[model samples]
Target: MITGKNYIGSQLKAAGTKIYKTINPQLNIENPWSFIEATPEEINEAVALANDAFKIYKNYPAQKKADFLNAIAEEILALGDELLEVYCSESGYPKGRAEGERGRTIFQLRTFANMLTEGSWLEATIDTSIPDRLPLPKDDLRKMLVPLGPVVVFGSSNFPFAFSTAGGDTASALAAGCPVIVKSHSMHIGTGEMVASAVIKAAKKNNIPEGVFSNLIGSGVTLGTSLVKHPLVKAVGFTGSINGGRALFDLASQRPEPIPVFAEMGSINPVVILPDALEKNSKKWAAAYAGSITLGTGQFCTNPGLLLGIKGEKLNQFIDQLAEEIEKIAPSCMLHPSIKADFNNGKEKIQSQNGVSTVAEYKGEIAPNYAPQTILTVDGKTFLENPALSHEVFGPFSIIVQCKNNEELLTIINKLDGQLTGTIIAEPMELSNYNAVVDALQNRVGRLIFNGVPTGVEVCASMIHGGPYPASSDSRFTAVGIHAVKRWVRPFSYQNWPDELLPSALQNKNPLNITRTVNDIITNKPI
Candidate 1:
């Protein structure tokens, strides 16, 4: 029932010499379906179609856009169990995870739908003319956020639903009135196409333009590179490894007209454990972290890969109990064989480094692509002296750093690279005394968690999923939440223009009934 063809708008095309098949990671076998990679010509055509669609989609009424978004969610939900089956078969994830992610995806789509319906995302502003001023008269100026043309979204390998084709990037781009061209993740192209079909069906149901969405199938760099360097792609959204994201970032920057690439890359997500917390509730925190470190096979970007604490008898006991807790849990199959191999290689390299001590490693392996849980520890001096020791291993793996004292711990925390999230475990009011440590962690991470593991990210209005460089290409934008739409938009001003000729949101009539800053005051009043 799956068609291994590219969704170039509403059209399905299978014209390309390059072909690949999805692998059943648990069985280490190939799936029956074969996918045709998108050729350069097909890529060009998709971008051209998207650019054309953007011209009209950008000016659509907020209600119309909301309708399209709601339609997408409905169609996806219609897929139901079939979608979950294919997702589980291709990605080796359980039905529960697939269903949960599908629900999250649907929730995200509906959230954007509601946001657009409310008609307040534009951030409209106005300053009326002062023609009778004593000095030079001020000209009327109005400004609001507008779509930034076509966007290219690269689907994530690990997250087939929430961050793949028709995922956050696609949802936010479409919500901002920009046509989206998604480079489907090779690991789950079938799953990608399944979701892409729902999107195309929704587009038609809602009477949206033909090129409002496109999903391209590929397993190589050629497809992604061509799209990123294309002149029509005004912005890009990517979620992947550091090297992969940086490659697209560099390619986009070197284009004839440089475009923005909002890439969510690597993060260690360091967790600092203060002394009092260990003395009071060491066992509780230990049990919690054991589950968090190995959650979802440690595939989460916000997974607490690094744990910091001052050296003491209590810390040693906590470490031992935590390691034992991780080993007790069963291992799960990773998304692909390559991911398993990478985990093995990266973990081995980190373990081989000097002064590293093994805590607990899962000795019972189950399947072809199952990742074994690992917990390693090293002294603070060794970690600080060796910068290579701080890199992420990217699986159900964690490294605990034992510091001589709080000073060394803060120094180690201060020296870390940019991260998606950071955590501090301490007794009540203990964090207040370590203001400098808190500030240092705050500077290094985009989100700060107090006495909590950084495993689950809540999708909402106030969440900051992006952080300083290496965590993401830019810290000012988020790849989650409703605000994610801002990445695909830019501010535009209309100066001294007639109300009839201006955008509906900026017109003096206040047709949208959305809040606007008029003469430095926020109001929804009509002139």
Candidate 2:
């Protein structure tokens, strides 16, 4: 059923001569399907249709939008085994991983649908007129969040289901009443096409406006650049490397009317181990970290790339144990040949650095596209001097930094770049003496973990998936959960507007019956 054509507002077209095919990384061969790249004309049509649809879609009622999102979830589930088959063949992930990611994708859509039905996310506020005040009378005012026109979502290379087309970005944008245009990741274009079909089916089933969702195929930056620079695009959502995200961010910023690009970039997800804990639980912690570093072939953005500990006999013991444990785990296939090549190149670059020593490596012969796990060690002074040691290796690779003492460990943490997560492994009473270290680590990461791995990201309201600076473009927002809808919306105010003309959430009649602040009081009652 894969047409290998672009989805331009419910219409399929492949006018461009450019064509490409996805690869089966496990088989190390191209898949049977071929996809046509979106041309300049197709890109323009998609953006134009999205701009036209936004006018009607932006004013849709909360219940209606909720219906559309729910329908999308249902249609995606309807894809059944076909979607999973495509996901596995295109990405080399196991069937279980494909199913899990598909479930997560469905859960995200349904969660947003439920949120819309509650109708309280708008944060509506109103202030009635205050006549005959001491000197000046205040006019009535009301404010609420409104959707930005159109959004461009760039799919991620690692996650085809959870972070690609019909993922969090698309679901949240639709929930915010903004049209979404997805720039499908080339490595998994087949999977992207399948998911786009489900979205289009849902849009048609729910009578949603055309161009409310689109999936465009392109292997390079040309299509992405065009979409970002388009005047009709009001915002962007991206999850990828720092270089890729930075390029899009720069393009958006240089536009005549700059737009906000919420890019979730790279992270090392550093883990700090206290002396007492390592001395007591060296073997246990080492085994656990080995599993975390190799989880998902170390492709997770939250992978523990760097581990810090005080240099001592206990630390060396932990390193030896970790190396042994990591070498035992079987090597796994990466997403694609390019990803495998990059992982090898990254490992070579780190190995070539000064003062770096390999603790252990998988010496067994591996199949093509399989990444061998590696563990390296370095001293605190050398790591601090050569910043290159801290860069993420993006595979089943981790570097342990042996600090001179607690002071050196704290200094290293202070100098580290922003990260998605930071972990502290310490004995029950060990934390009381290292408050400064805890504070510094907290200041540099979005989420701080106590005696837990950062490999899993829970989808919920309390989760903060974004962090300061390089961790994400804006720390104030997240790329997960219901709160993500806020990224595609902007707050607007109306002064002395007629009650009948005001939005339902802001009207004096309380037509929506949703929670709102009126005269500094939170209530659902009418004015």
Using lDDT as the measure, the top candidate is 2
Model 1 Cα lDDT, one tens digit per residue, 239-272? 9999999999999999999999999999999999
lDDT for each of the candidates?
Answer: 0.92, 0.93
Clashing pairs in 1: none
Please, what is the TM-score per model? 0.99, 0.99
lDDT of 2: 0.93
Residues 70-118 of candidate 2 have per-residue lDDT tens digits of: 8888988999998899999999899999999999999999999989888
- Residue 123 displacement in candidate 1 (angstroms): 0.7
Predicted structure 1, TM vs. truth:
0.99
Name the lDDT value of residue 373 in candidate 2: 94
